[model samples]
Target: MMWPFDRCRINENDLFKHDWRSRSKVQVPQYIFLKWTLAFLVGLLTGLIATFINLVIENIAGYKFLAVFHFIENERYLIGLAYFTGANLILTAFAAVLCVCFAPTAAGPGIPEIKAYLNGIDIPNMFGATTLIVKIFGSIGAVAAGLDLGKEGPLVHIGSCIAALVGQGGPDNYRIKWRCLCYFNNDRDRRDIITCGASSGVCAAFRAPVGGVLFSLEEVATWWRSALLWRTFFSTAVVVVVLRAFIEICNSGKCGLFGTGGLIMFDVSDVIVTYHATDIIPVIIIGILGGFLRSLYNYFLHKVLRLYSLINQKGRMHKLLLSLTVSLFTSVCQYCLPFLAKCQPFDPSTTEACPANGWSGNFKQFNCAKGYYNDLATLLLTSNDDAVRNIFSSNTPKEFQPVSLLIFFALYCILGLFTFSIAVPSGLFLPIILIGSAYGRLLGVFMGSYTNIDHGLYAVLGAASLMAGSMRMTVSLCIIFLELTNNLLLLPITMLVLLITKTVGDSFNPSVYEIILHLKGLPFLDANPEPWMRNLTVGELAESRITSVTLCGVEKVSLIVDVLKNHSQWVPYCR
Candidate 1:
């Protein structure tokens, strides 16, 4: 198949046509300065974007939870349910409208498109200015509405958008013309900058700068160089600086529960991981089960997204309707399902408060007795970020009942299935982690009699396993998980789980992003080639058509263009 807008290998003539270093107006030193400046700007803008999404989600979700809790506590169940569902509907509908009316490409987890771009395929409107705006606001609405979406994927898109704009000397429509930015207008320079942007994305999202660089190299970018490595590292360093500054600035509880946890989003450093060799039985089980479940998740997600695409192809209104319907369904499940959970009696002797009533806590007092905390309520009542923290919190093995976790995991599994690809900026990262964490907690609770290790460690490993199973990432995921949890002691098991799950998942099907790319029919190429590709030589494709052309001789531009037209773009030098 002919790849649209194909960028074939650069021949010697391209040096005179496009090389930045040889340009009369562009000095190498000045160009380097501009590149670094743009990298800093990309990181700064991406970090600010992440901060904006987090602050908005926390404030809106917190107030909604508090208001619903007040009504529920006062025995106004119908009013509470009405308010909850209405809030979700409105928020989700706003995001749906943004994606449907403003920019349809802003919908869904955008990692697949980003992967395509970094792999040298250019998809239209994938990183446009309008898409950036829609994704920024749409992500807020989707997550704040309590849908099973994450902001990391959209943030990555936003970073790439900013980088693309910078590569073009700002938005073309705005008509900002600067000679310094002209050096990056070429495809090669732009791709490199976008790679830095991709790394900055993960850096800001997880506060893991190193993982960001590794993620760009391992998962996204097909081309790599030592210079690009330094640029990507610099970009992520800037992101951490900006994110850290904001975290410090927002530490006084002014931003409505945004940066309370500091750089480590989930701080389990105090957990004291003490797993015996025999304790690895649970980790192995978790890896196998998490891999199976998440692979199944990818399969179902593909089917659901395909069905949504068909329904959405009819009109934009169908998109809005689907989102609203899912919002209502999620609201019902999140609100009513807690009643089925059996309350666990709170221990007064613990240092932390029982039935805590702040924005987030391990114990939730939802219509339970004064001395007891409802487990399901704790999982469903708070924001996803807080839910992750509470789940991964240390010494909380019995915090949630097995039945409560089972129901919670099952509810979200279905919720995530429908919530993705519904005309909103969604992501799979946190949603997968949440499901896996709960499943891990369930395993920990079930096997409590056999192991002495903290169940929180299992939850962490389970999260890594599910992520690896779905995404098929190795080193980068290992680092990101460690940075997110801040428990380096579990690195060995984390690596083991990731390797086992990734192998298990890959044995069945491609990664989720690959599935998305295949379904969308984007003509992208992966960095890793299959075994058959090794035996086939590039020259064989052009052998039949270019038999008369000389292999090494000067040729006119017209003759070269004519030869290119006859042969496929995938063909290398003709003989």
Candidate 2:
């Protein structure tokens, strides 16, 4: 079969010059088909490999990070500190060297480079192989370091490299034997490769196949045309199936990769807030504040990056030193004030805490964690509306404390932002999400105490909203959480908050991906502009001295067929 890229269409008038049957009979060679098939198979295998890397990172590095260091206690604050410092230093140092040395295209989100590739731009030579190695090492290192970052970013590149290898067709890669060709001769299908990788990465990370394709199209390709959808859907589906199958095979067909059991099967019970109507006003107020916070984060991060650039002019080493220093300070703060570090518990006495007690069914307030998990737990346990009412009405703490949480968030954002700027091979998807979630939860506590709304729900809302705001990826962020927990009851509210937050953030700052690319001196980083001809208006083209086409009834088929076979014939009558 002729691939879409190789097929040349014919118009009605071409029938005058060529025979339809002869041209229509043209077929793709077996060898070329084999190679393309092999590419797909290789991509499938690489997808599984990429998934393996992700699983290992997620479980070992993401959750039990301190496990990397046998000396530290599992949940001790020092383990967090050591994990953040020692690991970040080494990772930062490696990233610094990699930036100057290999210069792979896997830095920051990997989305931008994929975007550029799709638009016919060239990526670095070592983009594929180097990225696969660097991202796994650096991200694992970052996770081991405890920087509040995630592995979703690296997976994008890893997925893309898998695609590239499948499509591998450089001159040096060819053999002299008779498999003679299907390779596109040119090595510029970079976008296609990267898009494949990115789509698969997002899919594997969230276990939401369609969402991944939407993300690659919306956030990476920025291509919403009809034709590209099928390929994107097909590729994402294929990769996810392979990855999931491998996961099942590894877990003995019992869904071991996503989870074992209890955590995934827990159900939420209805909550009775004393005055549900009264809470609407407060919830709305929380949403408005959440939007504002989203905007603020974008603003602060941009300013921090500017400041970091101003202070560290020496090179990657200076930048590394600066980030290390900031990380150390954050680490120290996190250790001294355990409440400040990533994913801290909400405080009820303060207006900022999430009102988790209202939903938890657990009328005993302040017992749950600070974020989403707590919110769900709260929804099931709270029984008395009066208890919920009393909890909301109780006088919050007299004083506001920003010294620790604020400092920790600031440092965390700074380190994450600069890490992207420094060209470290890493994914910004999770880091940005983590940053948004952390900031949202911290602010959520204040809103909870002041507004009497559930901080847990607010934090969950914040996590999704902030992610949507920062990355400018609302659909994927919302869908990601849905798939992660397989819960949808709160989807509507999540989408509403995400919409407001995204709009607010866009008004203030470029999406994270665009900003990173802009920092690297890239052009049109947000959208890939079409070539000049495609950009031309139909009116202008029609008005030009160009040939036209016209078509009649039965002759249409013959004309098209003739055009297909002719070398230099006109098809001006198809229209």
Evaluate all candidate structures by whole-model CA lDDT and list the values in order.
0.82, 0.51
Per-prediction tally of clashes: 0, 35
Q: Mind giving the per-residue lDDT tens digits that candidate 2 earns over 263-329?
A: 2111112211222445555445545665666567666666665675565566656656754665455
378-425: candidate 1 lDDT, tens digit per residue: 889788888887788777667788888889889888988888888899
> lDDT: which candidate is best?
1
Candidate no. 1 TM-score: 0.92
Residues forming the 10-long window of minimal summed lDDT in candidate 1:
1-10
TM-score of each: 0.92, 0.64
The list of candidate 2 runs beyond 4 A from truth reads 1-43, 58-88, 91-96, 170-190, 222-227, 246-283, 304-316, 319-334, 339-411, 442-454, 525-575
